[model samples]
Target: MTPFWKLSAAGFAATAIAYGPARMGFGLFLPEFRSVFSISLQAAGFISSLGFFGFFVGLLISQFLTARRGPRPPIVLGLAAATTGMSLVAVASNLTVLSLGVLLAMLSAGFSWTPFSDAINRQVEERLRPVSLSLVSTGTGLGIVAAGAAALLMSIGGVSWRLCWALFAVGSAFALLCNWIALSGAGEASGVRRPLRWQALFRRATTPIFAIGLCYGVTSTVYISFAADRIAQAGGVPGLPANLSGSLVFICYGAFGLLGLVTGQIKTLTGLPWLLRLLLLASALSSVLIALAPASWAGVVVSAGLQGINVMMTSAVLAFWSDRLFPAFPSRGFTAVLLAVATGSVLGPVAAGSFASHFGVTAMFLATAALAASAALAIRSGYISETPHPE
Candidate 1:
């Protein structure tokens, strides 16, 4: 196998474990966590917020490590965090331990993503870099699919949630092993590392990228944290148990997320502006579908599917976009974009939880849909460049 293929495969597995079972799984299992821990929606939101905050911390650390050392250290460190964090979640007997585990696990996502930009730039041919990044981003959905399937089967078999988390830890460990082997003897950073230039980092040309990131963070976090709970409360689809229905939503999410591998092709055909508009619209529609028909199995499944596609595609777009915008500092610039996203993530759950307490989850989802729609309108209003910024 070629180096690009090897790195892509290992990167895919690393992202799958870090984002899927380790990071996103908390929301997937939120209902059960609530039941066991006897926490309220508000508390759950707080925990979710804490996890995103941890992601913010991880991103900062990752940028530093990736800039100074290389992609290997941060990537390996992230998988190790996934393995350890999920293990703690698996065996936690108290809410405090669970929260700590979740924070550590979510941190892996921050660590896991940005370094790949550096790796791709270092390892792959320039023309193939975007494709590799998109493929790696698609791993997020596959991981979700795997975790959701496991949860569904376990739910049916009456297995313990703890056991499910333990299995997740095992998967994380395997991902760690894959990355360790794949990244062996990887090249470290070369030359004198320059500090980030905030002026270049915060250009008017990049406004839309940061805006989209923030909006995506809010909307996606809200959906991931609450959509399943809302579906369960709506009694799920008829003829199926609520838990199964929820799991199926994520399955649809992960399965259709595979479609994001085509994002580079789509961007080539449609250009970045149109792609951003379309993705934002899909995100809006995903939330609107749930807001309008949470109880409809078809509605929820389609909603999850659209969200999965939008998320994966948008991530790929952001990866290449930032890489192009800051060719000299691919990982650093990408970290800035991710930090914006993480900031929104940090605020989304807590705010949504509070809003849901007042208006209702459906209402909160509608509000989120509106936010996404407004972002799409912003794109249509010439807020973004039709093509990528020059290197």
Candidate 2:
């Protein structure tokens, strides 16, 4: 394989290994943490939110660093941080220490993502960008599956959750090694340049892009934070088995990513707006089903699968639109959306957790469904337009 494809594959592997076990698995393990530590649900939510907040901080910092230094250094730093973070989590004794570990892990994950994505966008040909990115995004789903399997394995072995974390730490180290080997000699070929100003980058993206960012942030946050919990509640599954629920959620996510890969080609053959509309509608419908599904495991699985398809489709659409809108600065433009995503991620868990505490998990799912519906409408209303290009 060519170096570029190899890099993309390595990036996919790294992302799946890091985020699946570290970030998304946190939710799978949340009930355990809450039970073991005797913490309030809100406190548990805040702990997860803290990690997301760290991701936001990391992304903001990465924007400047990547613009100036290119992607390699940040990527390396991110991998190291992730390794350290997960290792710390393996031995954390208290809520505070666990939260600290989560924060660091998320920061590292965000750092890795921003620079790696920036590198991919800069290096890949325009025509192949969407499929490449969709492939990369699919890594999250793969990671989720792997984490679920790991959790199940731990359960069978009668091992503590801490040992699972140690496994993740070991896996992250391997991923880091792979990243180093793949990226070696790649950076020197591209000359280093001075970092661009954040203000200038923002000016170029305009309000529409920012709106898109905001929309994405809100929708994704809601989905990621609540999808599994909603499944547990809706399916009448107990909290102990929620990791299985998360595994189901990721299965849907991965399946939809594959769908996005197939549908992305339609955009090349037909038009962008049609595909966007289809994805938006799918998102809306999935939200509705998730909110309204009867309390059964089967319902939860179906709902999660639908929502996954919607999310993966939206991901492709966003990537395609960002490239068109900010052709000159794809990394900066994409980062703006990613920042919004991180912000939403931080807010989503807090809001859902609080609502679930006060009202119930059902109410939380309904609220998330409403937000998804609203986002779908916003995309359909023609408020957002693809930048016209010369054919």
Candidate 3:
């Protein structure tokens, strides 16, 4: 196989394990976790927030590592963390162990994704870089599909949820091995080690990227952390078994999320700014749909499909956009964008929990929709330039 093909496969596997089973599984399995741990809804939200905070910590470590070392080390460490973390969750006998496992698993996501920006920048031909990045991100959809399938099977077979996590751990280990081999000779940068410049992160050129990241982060993570729980609480899809209904929505999410593979073409045709605006509109629609019809099988499934596309497409846009913005240090610039994402993710669930407590989950969803709509309008008003700024 060619180098691009190899990178695509490895990057796909890396993202699949990191984002799907490791980071996203917590939300997918939140209902089970809450029941088993005897935790309240508020407590569950807090744990989700803590996991996002851990993601932030991983991003910080990865930014410096990718700058000093190469993409491979952080990528490898991230997969390893996913493997170890999922293993712990598989056998957790108490809430503390489960929380620690979740933290480590989510942290892997921060480390796993951004390094690919640097890797593609250095390894792929410039003409193929955006397509390659989109291909890599589409792995998250596949991962979600696989996890949802496993969950559906578990429900049918009366298998334990722990077994599901064990399977996730095993898959993570496989991804780790694939990335380690595929990234051979892809390590250790030759450069002066220095602190990431605050100025670079705060530049006018990057303002829209940061703002988009923050808004999308809040909207996306809140939905991920609680959507299933809300659906499950609403008694799930009418025709399906209660346990299977929630899982089915994610399968739709992953299936539609595969649409992310076409993101490069879409961006080429529509331009990045327009693409971002459309995606934010989709997100707002998704949040509002779920809030309005959490129990409707068609409604929640459609919401997941919209969210799936938004999640995958936005990730690809951010990767290439940051690469465009900071060619000399793609990972470093991407790190700043991801940090903004992580910040919003950390804030999202906590604030959402408060909203859910004071009002209801419906209120939380409506509020997130409003935030997404406001951000989309801001972009429409030319708060962000229509094209990438000149380097």
Candidate 4:
């Protein structure tokens, strides 16, 4: 494989482990976490909320780390954190240790994503940026698959959540090694260290992009943190899936989400603006299906497929759009995108979790649908500007 292709491979490993298992995997196994800790719905939501906050912190640090040094170190650090953190979660006996493990794993997401994007961008020709990024986004789908497979394995072997997490940590170690080999020296910054310009980073022209980020952030998190839980709920106990088992729903979601790898092709046909709008609509439609008929296998299958498509499409759009708007500072543009995403990460679980705890999971999905609809309106209203094209 070419060097850029190698970078893509490393990125896939990093993202799969960091975002997929370290971050998204938490929701997949929230039932186990709650059972072990004897926590309430509110508590599980709060724990996920904390993970997002850690994600925010990691984003902030990534801004500096990628800016000064390069992608490899931050990627390495993030993967290491994931390796250690998930292991902690695996072995923890109390709430405090479990919380710490969760925090570290989420924080690893911050470190892995942006830096690697920088690395990938650096490795590829300009024409290939969107395609490359889309390839990396697919890693999340792969990672989710890994997590789901682990869940399936757990079911087959009667493995404990703790044991699964330990296995995840081992997987992270492999990811870290993949990154080290692929990005070492290849991704390190070369020129004089330049500070991120706040003015450019927060310019008025990019407002619409930020708005898209916000909409995506809120909607995606609600789904990521709760989608499986909803599936499980429909499948069993008060908050747990006592029926089809957690792995089945997650495998469906992960498998369908792989559609995002084609985001570059969609962008090529529709352009960034329309693509965002369309995907947001897709998200809304998926949310409604799930909210209206959580237990329906048809609804669940379609919902997972749609959610998977939009989730990857949204990320590819943001990266592609940023390339069009701020070619000089991809990292900062990504930071803005992630900041909105991470901000939503904070709000999504809290709102969804609390709503689910009080009213029902369906109510939370309805709220998410509303969020997606508003985002589509924002796009239609020119919140992003009238056909932004890079010079």
For each candidate, give its TM-score against the true structure: 0.94, 0.85, 0.93, 0.90
Candidate 1 Cα errors over 4 Å, as ranges: 125-131, 386-391
Most accurate candidate by lDDT: 1
lDDT of 2: 0.68
lDDT of 3 by residue, 202-288 (tens): 667678888899988899999999888888887887877755666876788889989877887999999877898899999999999
* Model 2: worst 10 consecutive residues (lDDT sum): 382-391
* Model 2 bad stretches (over 4 Å): 117-135, 188-206, 230-243, 266-274, 277-281, 284-295, 388-391
Per-residue C-alpha lDDT of model 2 across residues 1-391, encoded as one tens digit per residue: 6656866787887778656766765676765666677866677668778888888888877777776677777777777777788888789888777888888877776777657766666677777765566666667767766776777677667788898889888888888888888777446324655355446545422555566556556555566655655555444444545445555565555555556566567777756655655655565566566667634556656666666666666666676677676666677777877777777778877877787799876676677767756655565435555663221
Q: Global lDDT of each model?
A: 0.86, 0.68, 0.85, 0.78
Please state the error at residue 149 of candidate 2 in Å. Answer: 2.4
Tens-place lDDT per residue, model 1, 166-236, is 99999899989989988885689777867677567787788878988999999989888887777777888
The true-versus-predicted C-alpha distance at residue 152 of model 3, in Å, is: 1.0
**Best-first order by TM-score:** 1, 3, 4, 2
Ranking by lDDT: 1, 3, 4, 2
